[model samples]
Every structure is written in C-alpha cells, then in structure tokens.
Target: MPLNEDLPRGDAEYLSQSCFQFHEVPGSKSVTARALFLAAAARGTTVLRMPLVSDDSLGFAEGLAALGYRLEREPDRWTVEGRVRGPAAEEASVFCRDGATTARFLPVLAAAGRGVFRFDASAQMRRRPLGPLTRALRDLGVTLVHQEREDHHPLTVHADGIKGGHVTLDAGLSSQFLTALLLVGPLSEQGLTITVTDLVSAPYVDITVAMMERFGVRVQRDGNTFTVPAQPYTATDYTIEPDASTASYFLAAAALTGHRVTVPGLGSGSLQGDLRFAQVLARMGAHVALAEDHVTVTGAPGGRLAGITVNMRDISDTVPTLAAIAPFADGPVRIEDVYNTRIKECDRLEACAENLRALGVPVHIGRDWIEIHPSRPRPAHIACHDDHRIAMAFSITALRTPGITLDNPGCVKKTFPGFHRALNDLRTIWHRDQ
Candidate 1:
C-alpha cells in the first residue's frame, strides 16, 4: 500500500521549515458526552458552547432524542432542555452505535427513570464486556436481563426507579462503569455511595466529577469511596475545551517532523489528563511551551528523540500516538500499564504493535505493555481495525515513512471526522516549506 510516489525522501523530508501556530482541534468528546448527560438530568436548559460534532457526540444526542429529550443543535452550539424526572418517553430502544460512553452511560441513566429501556450496540461494542456495570446496577435494585450474551450489550432494563444506597464496584476494566454510576447517583432516592475495589482511566472519573460539580452537585470522596447525595443537577451554559487526546497526534506530528504545532483552547488550564502527552514529548527531547491559554510543540533537534520507558496508566489514549513515532527515537520506547486499551474499540496496544511490525520496526507486546525499537521503517499497508485512534495514529507514521495507507481511514469519524483533511493541511504546509 505505497502511495503513487514517495514525496518525502532524499531532499524533501517534511521538516521544521515552518511554524504551524494556532493549530486548533475539535471540542472534547469526553466533556461533550458528560455535558449531554448532565444537561438531560438538570432542571433548566443547558447551553453547550463549541461541542464536538462527530458520530459519537451525535449518537449521544440521538439517544437523548429517542428518550424524548428536547435539543437544538446549531453549527457551533447545542442547547438541551433539562428534565429531572428522567426520559420523557416511557420506553425506548437505543442503538449505541460504536461509542463506549454512549453504550455504558445510557443504561444507567435509564435506570434512574421509571421506564423499561432496551439498549443495544454495534457488533464491535457487543464484543466488549458490560458485566461489571450491569452487576453494579443489579446490586442497586435495578433489574437487567442480557438478551444475546451474558454481561454483554443487547440487554433490557426493567426500570422502576433507582433507590440507590451503597454499592461495591470493580471498575478495573473500564472507568466508564464507575462514571456511569456516579452520573446517576443524584437520581436515587437515598443518593449513592460507591466503593470502588479497582479502577482504570481515573482521570475520566475526575472529568465526570468536575462536570457534575459544574452542574451544581457535590460528590465527596475519601480514599476509594465516593459519596453523592440525592440532589438535582443545576443546568447552566458550559464551554467545552478542545480534545487533548486528539491534540496529541498534532503534537506528536510536530515533534517527529521538526515543525511547530500549537493548539489553542487546550492549555495549562485544561481539565483533560491527556494533555500530559506534551510532557512525554518534552521528556523525549521536544521543545514544548505550555502557556496559560495555549500549548505549542516544536520538533526536537533534527526531528530526533531519545526513547524512554514511560507509564501511561492515566493517559493511555495517547499510547498509539507515541508508539507511531517511536521508531524515530534513538532508543527503545516502552509503554506500560495500558491494559484497559484492549477493551476499547479494538485492542489498541496490539494494534500499535502490529502496524509497527508491518513497517519493519521491532516491537514487543506484553499483557499490558508495548516496547517499540528504533529501525528504518519500511512502508506497508496498515491494518486499522476500524478504531479511530488506531487510524489517526498510524497516519502519523505515513508522514516520514510514506506509502502508509489505512484500510479504514473513515473510522476517525468516531471522534474526529476531519482528521485526515486537517492533518493533510498541516502536511501541505510542511511540504511547501520543504
């Protein structure tokens, strides 16, 4: 799967010949999804500013609409009329498409209302395990029955209402399980106390708690226990920051191509933990300037970096981004503690390892880790697994190696529909300067 011709070899490598300041990414999908849920649970209309318009975000809104929630979606703004009483429709069948947030969060939201809700997801989502969240809901007195598989999607919730109290949850596989329960905590008659035995993607839960606070609900935490009182969310106008995870690709591109890429609206004040990927690049010899309102990454000397071992337990979403450029480093890039990535749209760790090997790089995969070694990468067709992150990450590899095309480039629609066009725009600038 080489391109028609190689554009960046011999004399014309896409280098740091230009500065790409004000490189803007789309809105945060995490913040947008949480905002939609909070808005639906509030008592007044919530105005969302600059929310992401992607398949995942739109699917969440479509689910809301199916449940009889009213919304107005303009070009750059979305307004949701709040309803504390839960789904306006007595019953609904929701297709979660391929978003894990929609698949996981909606069922619990339905549990808080007095209705029987049937939730099903795409074949990809159905493969992921939902047992932990389902068990936690069952423990809360919410009756659920799996239709096609045990502890899987294609399930029905015979919801009378949630009289939530105390529940023990093991969220080691996914943090959405914990976040979903926490989101529905206020709807219970007696509130909720969630004792988490294990967890992953802890930063996502932090996002949930922070957004919940913005909607005027307080969640108390002591060690591993979280306590949320019976309360109603207060609706308000909320501005969503740009996606830090998506910004990682652009930042990594800047590092590998010896160019400068600055992202606006995601700076030091950003709520996302994935912004820390910039520090990871900085540690690998990139020049990173994180201002109060923006962040910029210029490539390292000669677009070269020294590889290092890093733990991505908190910011695992950027694992693929880093791995795509690992071959350019001087040493070995070892990423650790990212097991939860396996349960995503695809097994991301192995997928990264697979594509790296396809390009003639040395890569090793463990149960929860991957180590990529430096080598002269030979371009080949990349297998994208239809995961948006996987497709976008490998597109970075094509910049230097060239001739790298994905089988499913459109998978980026899950969060970033315009990813290829945006990356190509920057690529065009870099190529012109060269």
Candidate 2:
C-alpha cells in the first residue's frame, strides 16, 4: 500500500554495477538502543553522537519521552537528561512499535523506576516470546501482568523498584532478555547476580557489559554468573560506531560483483559482534582489509568465491547476507547454529530458503542450519516477510542477477532508509579509459 496522496508505483528497482565506493553507514542499531537506555538511566546529562535515526532507535527515544524523560534531538546528536531516580511518571504505556529490544528492555527499566508501565507492541512484536525476561522480573519481585496472553506482549508491570538479588535467566530464546536485566541491575538496592542457562548469542552480553562500563557501571562476570554492583550510572558523552550488520550488505555486494567497497568507522576495533562478518567474507575468498577507521572488501579474483561451512552463532544476523551470496559460490554453503533466527522478525531461516527457492536455487533446511547448493538463479519476486534483513540481503543478489524484486520494499525503512540509493551509488565508477 502506498502512502496517502501517493499513487502505487509500478516496476521493481533492479540493482547493477561494479565500482569502488566508500560509504559511512548509519550508527549501529544495537548500540543506539543500549546507549539510549543507559543515557535515560544515568545521573546527569548524557549526549549520544551519531545515533541511528531509524524506526527502532526513534521508537526507543519516543517511548522514553512518553515515560516523562526529556530527550533533546539534533540532526546527528541526542542529548538526554537522566532522571537519576528513574522515570518521572508513575503510570505510563510504552509502545515498542516492532522493536524487540524496546519491548524486552523497557519492562526491566520500568521495574527499576517508580511506576507501573503497560508494554504494548506491534502485531508482529506481540507474537514474540517474553517468558524468560518477564518471568525473571517476577522472581526479582516485580509485579508483571500479561494483559493478553502469558509470555507475550501487551503486558503491564507494577514496579515498586526491583530488589534484584540472585536470579537465573533462560537465555536460549533471545540474548536481549539477559541484556535487559543486566542494564537495570546496577540500579537495584541489592544489585543483581544473574546466572544464565542455555545462553545463545553470548557475544551480545559482552556488548552490553562493555557499554555499561562506558556509563560508569562495572559488571562483574565469572563464567555464566554476572554480578552488577549497586551503583549509579554516571552520564558521559558517547559516540556510536557505524552498524557492522548494515556494512555486511555492501561487503556482500563487493564479493558478488568483483569490486571494492569500504565502510568507514567500522573496523576490527569495534565492539559489535557482527564485525566478524568480514571474516566470513574473507573465508569465502573475498579480500577483506581492516584499517584503524574502516573495513574494506574486494571481490575474489575473476568474480568467483568459494563456498564455506560456517557456524554463525556469534554473528547470525549476517546469515541472510551469506545466504544471498551462497548461490554465486563455487560450492555449497552451510550455515549452522542459527536456530535463533526463527524467532526474529520472521522465520528467517525458512524465509531465506523460500526466497532462495524462488530465485531457482536449491536449498536444504535443517532445524538449525541451512545449506545452499550452487545453482543458476533465475528472476523471481522475493518476499521480504517484513524482515528488514531479508529485504537488504537479497538486494545484493539483484546486483548481479537482474530479475530479483522485493515484495515489501518499504520494509527497509525499519533500519536503512537510504538502502536503495546506496545500492545505486555502486554504479558511479571512474573508468581508466576516461
């Protein structure tokens, strides 16, 4: 459906070309979410530089405002004055608007404040499981009421502030659950000692801990047990790095087209686990270079890359990007340990297999793995399933293979609003003959 006063546009945008391009991608959505929440909890004022302006980040900023926190926004920076004690409102409703981070993290934040918060989500967000986080909150003495369904969204929290002692969290479903609890732990009277079981995507926990330290809160960790001391978060000016997950698409484009692409401000020094995606591309025969301030990927010789078998547990977000490039590989590409992909924005594993099949590629789907066998791809309409990753990942395939069209093109606005324009910029080349 088109916007009001805008007619439905015809024809699909086809991606093409081989050229060298350098682009600074948007701020990491993961980093932006953590920074926003930490800033809202910190004592005094905190400023975030180059924060992402996407639907997810904006949704978080707006939800905080609804809870009576003042966030002053500039074109590229955000200034938030922390209400040291917590949210000013005693009763508030936070609408996550399809941001899983917001849905998971806000409840815990509310529990630490002086209010009862009603958490609401989009139709898609409502379908996600919140048992681990919500149950853990209840055990910590926060009163949680599932307004609609148990372990699902549209829940209400009667927060008298969390006691936050010893608690165990089932981390199998989403790491954000652990991250949400960990973020609010330092504010508790007893602090928080959390023991995590069945923890997947463990690297994300490291990211949360690292960011907490940046805000003047130190989290003690030994094996699966984490202890956050009862301390106030000190406000600090922070600069967010470019999103490595978003950088993966352009890197994949270079791998597919035998060209060079560089994404500035994302490199080996970055805290994002998704930065390891460049390593996967390197294993697939792309020339990956990591500099102090940027990372670059040059296509394999003769525009052919070798397929690989990889365990994507630490970097599952790039599974779609790898799946898009798998068809062009010389052999089969098997992505393993990605069972969590199913519970994301959509059934990502099946969505990747379905879209690949639509493009005339043979794919084998397992309970936790996907194997893409090399086959000639034909033109097909790719269904994005409202997942931003699926939509962006397939755009890389469309560059070399002309017939790919995304069904829900507007879905890219969830993360990268300028994706199509950025993909088109690959056509700007300076030939030697000139």
- After superposition on all C-alphas, the RMSD of every candidate to the true structure, in Å, is 6.5, 8.1
Every model's TM-score: 0.95, 0.94
| Error in Å for residue 170 of model 1 | 0.8
lDDT of 2 by residue, 154-177 (tens): 999888887779999999988999
Task: Give the TM-score (vs. native) of candidate 1.
Answer: 0.95
Candidate 1 on 1-434: residue-level lDDT in tens? 11112111211122222366645599999999999999999999999999999999999999999888999999889999988877888899999999888999988888888788999999999999999999999998999999989999998998888998999999999989999999999988999999999988788898899899999998999999999989999999999989999999999998998888778787666788788888889889887776556777888767988899999988999999999999999999999999999988999998998899899999999999999999978978999998999999989988898788889999999999999999999989878877
Cα deviation of 223, candidate 1, in Å: 0.3
Worst 10 residues of 1 by lDDT: 1-10
CA lDDT of each candidate?
0.89, 0.86
Using TM-score, give the best candidate's number. 1
- Model 2 weakest lDDT span, ten residues long: 1-10
Per-model tally of clashing residue pairs? 1, 0
